[model samples]
Target: MGSDEDAVLAGPFWYGRWDETAREHHGGHARQLNRAARAAHYAEGAFDPDATRAAIAGLEIPVLILVGELDFSPSPVLATQLGELFAPGWVRLVVQPGAGHHPWLDDAARFGDVVTRWLAGS
Candidate 1:
């Protein structure tokens, strides 16, 4: 995330819910730092096309690509790419309006509805 967002989530004065220690230990300090270090180490710059394309093309199971309307992390356009990764007609794209990165956290009702409908269709 960018600076403002990161500050609100992690800064001492901005985080009204808890102190710095608590924030660091949201998943426990050791685990959190370990995860952060690992992520930094494996950070991406260029794509490994052959590996990525082959992995996607190899999947034969049904796939549901769900993205939030406000989430540009992976973007809704990714749904089309993901759909092509699965068997034809076996991929569904669901977008929840007004939702951000975590759609279920943003709107449980809509998220549940989508999941229920998908299960019913299956």
Candidate 2:
């Protein structure tokens, strides 16, 4: 992302709550940094709608959808859509507060607890 977009979009890419450690860590290991800009272009082409429909229809088992509260890209809104798609069954949707795209980095303890509880069927 450009400098102007970094202040906003980049935050979602990393963490909602920024710190020196977070900045240093992500900066040192910015995976796919070279092709970040081209990702949009690569994703713009047509996708297989039939495959997507079949995949959604095949999700018969319970699902636990987690989203960061501060993530704008795949925010809780997207999680809600997934929940709807997995309808007529148990679909747990979690919006971890103050979390960005990487919820574990934003709130590791909470993320672990949530996932543990979900896995334990609580």
Candidate 3:
């Protein structure tokens, strides 16, 4: 697979919001320069629209859809729409303030707290 759409994915900083730490954590070093190609191959297979629809068709458990405030891939607006697909009373959507694609990587404490509260059924 090729990352022709985003050349940045071929380097240490795959996304604009990530810093050196995230790069290191995600193995962006020279040894893994080929990471992007592998990621590209899996990314397409990671989410199958038809499979997703089938999986969530009768989901009865609560769903928490969290995204970073600055994430545009599945923007806050889009996340909200996704929440709507679930039973209204069973969905909660949260956009972590000041974060990008990965809120936990950007603000670990806040991310932990948010998730903790949700898991506690707060």
lDDT per residue for candidate 3 within 1-122, as digits (tens), equals: 44544544644333335677667655634455686886886785787878877677568898889887777868889998888777558888999887767678778898999899999999
The reply for model 1, stretches above 4 Å from the true place, is 1-47
lDDT by residue (tens digit), candidate 2, 11-120: 53557778875676566555636666657645755466677767876777778888999887687898788677664677889999998877888888999999999999
Taking all chains together, the TM-score of candidate 3 against the true structure is 0.67
RMSD of each: 6.5, 3.9, 4.6
Top-scoring candidate (lDDT)? 2
Q: Tell me which of candidates 1 and 3 scores higher on lDDT.
A: 3
The TM-score between candidate 2 and the true structure equals 0.72
TM-scores for the candidates = 0.61, 0.72, 0.67
By summed lDDT, the worst window of 10 consecutive residues in model 1 runs over 11-20
Q: Model 1: per-residue lDDT, tens digit, 1-122?
A: 45545644543322223444435534353343576766776678546778877887777766778787766656667756666766677778987887655576567788999998888885
What C-alpha lDDT do the candidate models reach, one value each?
0.64, 0.76, 0.74
Query: Which structure is stronger by TM-score: 1 or 3?
Result: 3
Clashing pairs in 1: none
RMSD of 2: 3.9
The deviation in Å at residue 23 for candidate 1 is 12
Clashing pairs in 3: none
- Model 1 TM-score, all chains together: 0.61
